[model samples]
Target: MPPVAFLHTHILVVVLFLVFFAIKAVLLLLNKRDTLDRMRSKTKIVDIVLGILILITGGYLLFLYSGRIPTYLIVKIVFVLLAIPLGIIGIKKESKGLTVLSLLIFLYVYGVAETNSLAMNKEEPSVAPITNTTTELPVKKAPEEITPAEAAQEEILNAMGETLMANAKAIYTQVCATCHGEDGGKGLGGAALLTQSQLTLNDRINVIEKGRGLMPAFGSQLTPQEAEALAAYTITLNTTN
Candidate 1:
């Protein structure tokens, strides 16, 4: 389970014991007419043993959730220490008021502990925008819908040959030049270390998509079109070198 929830469980156990102790202390103080023989012996022993258990469990919790020690836990520990002397005084003087006051302090400690536990348990909110701008843009209408002159000026793109080569050149200069050098001479940071038998276009594309050694995966960062363009561009790097 989560650290905060685990800590809260321990705190709940300790608080239950404190409540029982407080009630017994109050009752003993109110019924002074009865002989204090059995009450004094049993109350002292139970309180001391319970107190030690609380301390031990609290210390264990501190170690388990050591990554984050809330300020509230520190305050609760201080109040618990103060409650010890107040509890002793209540028993000695048989003061009902002191016992009630101790209970109130314990309640406050419980409240703070529960609140801090909830705050710590909460997940952090997301900061990324809902819509990605890089992959989405307004599509332009065909020039045929406009004037005839504009339609005539719209030259057909060579989807397989010249256009592909031009697109490959542009992609290569923009993305590959920083790593593979302008003349494919293995001069970039990682490229400089790679041997002649390093990798082919397909291997390089796989490494870029699924990060191998020092490179981070760009599968999520780059669009499919961008990845394809880069892959095609890389194939032509040493073609004319």
Candidate 2:
């Protein structure tokens, strides 16, 4: 299941439990004759079981799907803990304030869950060239007949192309690996980039340069030649036979 779906299901369960408990507590506080006799039998065994399930599923999503425990979950869990005392007070002493506090805490936890949910939907940033490498290639000498200006232009274009390729790789790692996997074949991230027919070398180049949907445009951040090189490199991802 998707992380979002799992989280939504657990949250819904928690909300249901909170609503049921809140109503029951309110009825008891009012000392309603219709509910007073039945209040003693309204044990929260089902709520406890549902709460445990929510905790288990939530833990799995945090540690497994996202691969890291988000701070938001920790904060939500703390508020949930606080709600426990409020729930106790509501049930034992028929405290309206405690019931209200419990409801407020439930809303706070839901808000935190929504915020953390966005963490999975983050868009990757455009790739930038790494500039600190010490290894330098010797520049080729231009023909004696060629003007210095022409040679300089050629050199600039070559450098620009190289930079684009480097940036493309970085972009691929950031945006594609989650679905295409690190090598682009395992499909661990979502789909196999290497095996996809929609993204030819030229198509990939265009997509990176122009972007489409979830992809961010690299043309603004990368030179055309650099984008071309990165596209070329991506073509070689699954061709190592």
Q: Given candidate 1, what's the lDDT at residue 97?
A: 79
Per residue, candidate 2 scores C-alpha lDDT tens digits across 143-234 of 78665654553353345444554665677677566545555553331233453333545677787687543244678876776676666556
The top-ranked prediction according to TM-score is 2
RMSD after Cα superposition, model 2: 15.0
lDDT for model 1: 0.52
In angstroms, give how far residue 172 of model 1 lies from its true place.
48
Candidate 2 collision pairs = 164-226, 165-226, 178-189, 179-189, 179-190
lDDT tens per residue, model 1, 92-124: 677777877776677676665544432334122
Report each candidate's C-alpha RMSD, comma-separated, in the order given.
21.1, 15.0
**Which segments of candidate 2 are over 4 A away from where they belong?**
1-5, 33-40, 65-68, 115-241
Q: Least accurate stretch of 10 residues (summed lDDT) in model 1?
A: 129-138
